[model samples]
Target: MNEQDVYDAIVTRRSTRNYKPTPVEPQKLARIIDAGRYAPSGGNSQTNRFFVVQKQEIIADLIKLVEEAFSKMDVYDGMYRSLRNSILRSKEGGYLFCYNAPVLVVVANKKDYGNNMADCAVAIENMMVEANALDLGSCWINQLRWLNEEPTLLEYMRKLGLPEDERVYGAAIFGYPATEDGKPNRVPLPRTGVDVVYL
Candidate 1:
């Protein structure tokens, strides 16, 4: 892909919170996961693991567990606003952080890896771009990563086959967008600056 294509993909990749009840096709989902796996890692370790979850019941159980986990935690100052919102919403009940998307891709990397979060975040961005290219809605879901080290959450994740030496660093929830016309919005907003400098 050229720079324009990449720019288009990045600009059009809006975070979708609302999703249709339909499931994402396995083939398309696989392509997105493949994009994630292709992301670069520190020292070419290539140890990032992408956990693709599609089972509805498992998703529901995870939602409940996540809500309960956040509900019991007291928010401290300087917490990310979104996470604080999640905690408050969970306390009030009914906070589906994933927005009931058909797929939740959890990116995990070795706990000892120095660039774990960086590599995992790149993978998630790749998956999100790929999902947008395939006309699917995608959003970054950070709650799992936030709770990745919690004892209860770690126990539950271990049951799901997360390696003992690995922890979630980022995640993406994806599905068909819940739009009236069944299409994800692709309008790009203006950007200020990334603080580039010319030689």
Candidate 2:
């Protein structure tokens, strides 16, 4: 892709919350993961691990666990809006945190590493950008990270090869969008905030 194309992808990328049952192709998935792996790490610590979850059974179980974990929590006045939303919806039952996407990529890093979340975030952004370039819909999933320390989740994740010393810092979903055109929504939201200060 050229310079303008890169800018276009970055500017138009939007979080896709709905998806079709059709799975993302293996080759395209690999390329997207590679983009994440190539993300810069602090101090050359490339310890971020990627778990590409495409198995329907596993995804179902994850949704169950995530909903269960959030259902147990009570919303607070100052809690993040998304977190509060999750809690409220979860209590109501059947809260699919991953938006029922066909492919869920769970990014984990060393629990003791100070840069774990930052590294995973950088990597997730890269993967999302790459997904947009590939014409695949993607959304950053955060419920897993919020309940990373929950025993039920940790146990289940361990069964999926998550190391005991590592924890989920971030995650994302990728798949063909369920929209009429089967393409991600590229209509950029109105840019109103994120003001920059010139020093």
RMSD of 1: 1.5
Candidate 1, residues 114-184, lDDT tens digits: the string is 99999998999999998998999999999999998888888888998899999999899999999988778
* Local distance difference test scores for all models: 0.90, 0.95
Q: Give the range where candidate 2 is weakest over 10 consecutive residues by summed lDDT.
A: 1-10
The residue pairs found clashing in candidate 2 are none
| Poorest 10 consecutive residues by lDDT, candidate 1 | 188-197
Give model 1's TM-score versus the native structure: 0.94
lDDT of 2 by residue, 77-168 (tens): 89999999999999999898988799999999999999999999999999999999999999999999999999999999999999989999
Give the runs in model 1 whose Cα sits over 4 Å from its true position: 1-3
- Winning model by lDDT: 2
- List per-candidate RMSD values in Å: 1.5, 0.9
Best by TM-score: 2
